[model samples]
Target: MVNSSALSGNDTESRETLYQSKFVYIAGIAEMIVVILLILCFCIFVCFNALILNVYFTTPHVHEHARYVLFVHMLITDILYLIASISLFLVAIYAVYIPMPICYPMLNLAALTFRITACNLAIMALERYVAICYPLQYFQFCNAHRANTSIILMWVVGAVPNVADFFAMQSTVEQDFFSRNVICDLSLLAVNPLQNTIRTLTFISTFTLVALTIVFTYIKVMQVAKKAGSGTSSASKAGRTVMMHALQLLLCMTAFISTVSETYLRDSPVMLLITNFLVFTCLPRFLSPVIYGVRDEVFHKYIRTFCLFNL
Candidate 1:
């Protein structure tokens, strides 16, 4: 009777282990599905953005200096965003399958690109501000040769800190293992006091500049509209369009802050999920195409022209 009882206990234990294994397998599969969905959405955004930019560039009539510069920067940022999303999706899928070696360098590189592209939206905002605020100075301020140099500097500034933090993180967290399934916690980006300081400062500065740009642009746009009165229908529409873009930019900035804050604070699941929703779940990217397409008279007209031509 004792021997029989021992054998039954062993069998029960085996069944429990199998159940746990199956649960883990299902969870992994679920995670993969989510990741794939994210990748698909990102790819669509990238392709659509590319197409719009191509139309803008190929049509000489639409290629004014201001639009040309904005188009180039938008294309570059979207491409970077696409690449970053791909990298992140791959990392998620890998985490579902295998133990990810703490890839600190790659994590920082991705973070840097995302952050930089985000921050560079400020430059675009600034351009729009100048264009609306001082129409006469627009040509002098946004000239192509000068714009090219500024764009290069913006990217460089965004990329440089990642290189520094990558090495710094390796130095500090190289031996630390947080989880069997974990890759890298970019929260360690704040481990170096100096990097943390600089990052915080950069975030504050970028936020202030972008916020000011939006405020100033709206104020100037409103003033112009008020002056023109009934004759200002076109200008009012343009102001509304810019206001929408500014709102989208605000969403992107909010997402970035939420994600970074959650990471640093090591917040609860609810907090993390909210951050993820803002950062990854099709909100900002969805707005990207809308803001650009609806606000851009050229893009709207050009798409019509293209469709008509094809028809």
Candidate 2:
């Protein structure tokens, strides 16, 4: 009876080992797929942004306008955000331990870009509102020079929460905190409860304000479009464009759910990979080229010409 019991115990242990190995194998495969998809998407969008910028800069009539200027700003912000975010993700996933001194600034830069992207969206919406609602004086308020200056102001405003976060991080950590080697992650940098609260509140408030601004612009543009009285009217087109910016903002807002997903779906590795890659990392950044450049009549021709020339 003793020997029989020993054999059964050995069998149970073998089964458990096999189960764990299988899970590890599956998790690895899922991670590889996610990384490949992320890299591919990032490269494609970067190229598209570059192509649009090239066209805009080379054409004087296109580049001189306030709308396209704002559009280019959004593209640049997206690129910066993508670089900071994807670099952090790759570092964490592959377990590249970075010193906190080097990592903190990176995390803060990512946070700042998040705020700036929303600010850019709001500014672009305001530009459209002025263009359609106050056609005669649109240049007075949303001129190319002012658009460039507003981009600078957005950077200043966006840096505020990050500055607060840095102080909050300092309050909790030890004197030698910068000497620690750690996986580069937003969660790691934001480990302090105060930091988390600040991030959550900041995200909600900034995005809410941006969404409201976009919505207001869309409504005003729609009212003007009605008076203009044609399906193909420029006012109607501008309304749709403002609506597109809102849709992009909506994608940005969906990232708020990552917090919820982490809480509930954290244990499911595959779901975590998909959610982080698709929702939190990639989707919002890709929408800018589609919404701003491809959808614009002036830019579309340039894109087509570029594509055909390349072909």
Candidate 3:
């Protein structure tokens, strides 16, 4: 008769092999789903931004306003942000490990774009304030040239803190059985106390200032709108537009918070963190075009027209 122990051992081995195979299959399916979602997000992002840009450029009335100029700059930043995010997602999927030179630059660009986006929102709030609270001076104060200059200045200012981040980064090579690559983990930037302090201060200060400006300006706008009676129906409309922008700003800030806290979340499951990051990144982009299209009359009119013609 066959030994019972031997048969039992063989059964156990077979069960182990089956379990491993099933795990691998499940993991592969999950990866494929992640990739498909990323592609879908990329397509939607490009399409929405393209729609806004087309409307801004093709319609003379839309382009004449300074606010649309800021919107265009914001859209450019979102495109860059999407590209950076896509690069990171691809690296995570395909690369055994990302090299420091590759990783740091991508992260820094992402950070810079995020900062510029915040600045753009604050500036947009100021523009709205001027338009609503001080209507007579809106044209004189917020002309196209000034709007363009502000956009340039936003990029320049946004780059300063990220430059510090680039210099402060440290990297080392990590090795697996088959391959080795440099890992410039962002948490390393915080290892240096001074660098960490600087980064924290700059981040908090920049965002705080922008947030305060937006809040204060909107409060003033609302006050003016309330006081101006029925003659200021446009002011009420502008308030709704500003409210949409505020919602967009809040969404972006939530993403920023998630990114900043990533180091603290090192113990969390890697896949979970990645999934959360992707949601935060895509949510704002998906909603931005919708918000603008619904809230802004010119954008709404053009989007409807374009949709109908295409249909």
* Residue range 1-311, candidate 1, lDDT tens digits: 99999999999999999999998788667656666666676676776676687876787755556545755576666566556545644544244333435454456555565565555566665666666667788889887766677777877877776667656555675464434455344553456677776667766776677677667777777777777795556456557755765776766665565455555554443323433643653457656675677557777787677668976
lDDT for residue 264 in candidate 2, whole number 0-100? 69
Error of 1 at 179 (Å): 22
- Per-residue lDDT of candidate 3, residues 20-133 (tens digit): 999888877876787677778778778867888888888887677889999888888888887886677556535447665667678788778887888898899889989988
The TM-score ranking, best first, is 2, 3, 1
For each candidate, the alpha-carbon lDDT, in order, equals: 0.62, 0.82, 0.75
State the displacement of the C-alpha of residue 10, model 2, in Å, after optimal TM-score superposition: 7.2
Q: Number of clashes in every candidate structure?
A: 0, 0, 0
The CA root-mean-square deviation of candidate 3, after full C-alpha superposition on the true structure, stands at: 4.0
Worst 10 residues of 1 by lDDT: 266-275
Worst 10 residues of 2 by lDDT: 254-263
Residue 147 displacement in candidate 1 (angstroms): 3.2
Which candidate do you rate higher for lDDT, 1 or 2? 2
Top candidate by lDDT:
2
Model 1 TM-score, all chains together = 0.73
The deviation in Å at residue 157 for candidate 1 is: 4.3
Ranking by lDDT: 2, 3, 1
Candidate 1 ranges beyond 4 A from true positions: 1-19, 85-89, 92-112, 115-119, 156-184, 188-191, 257-283, 304-311
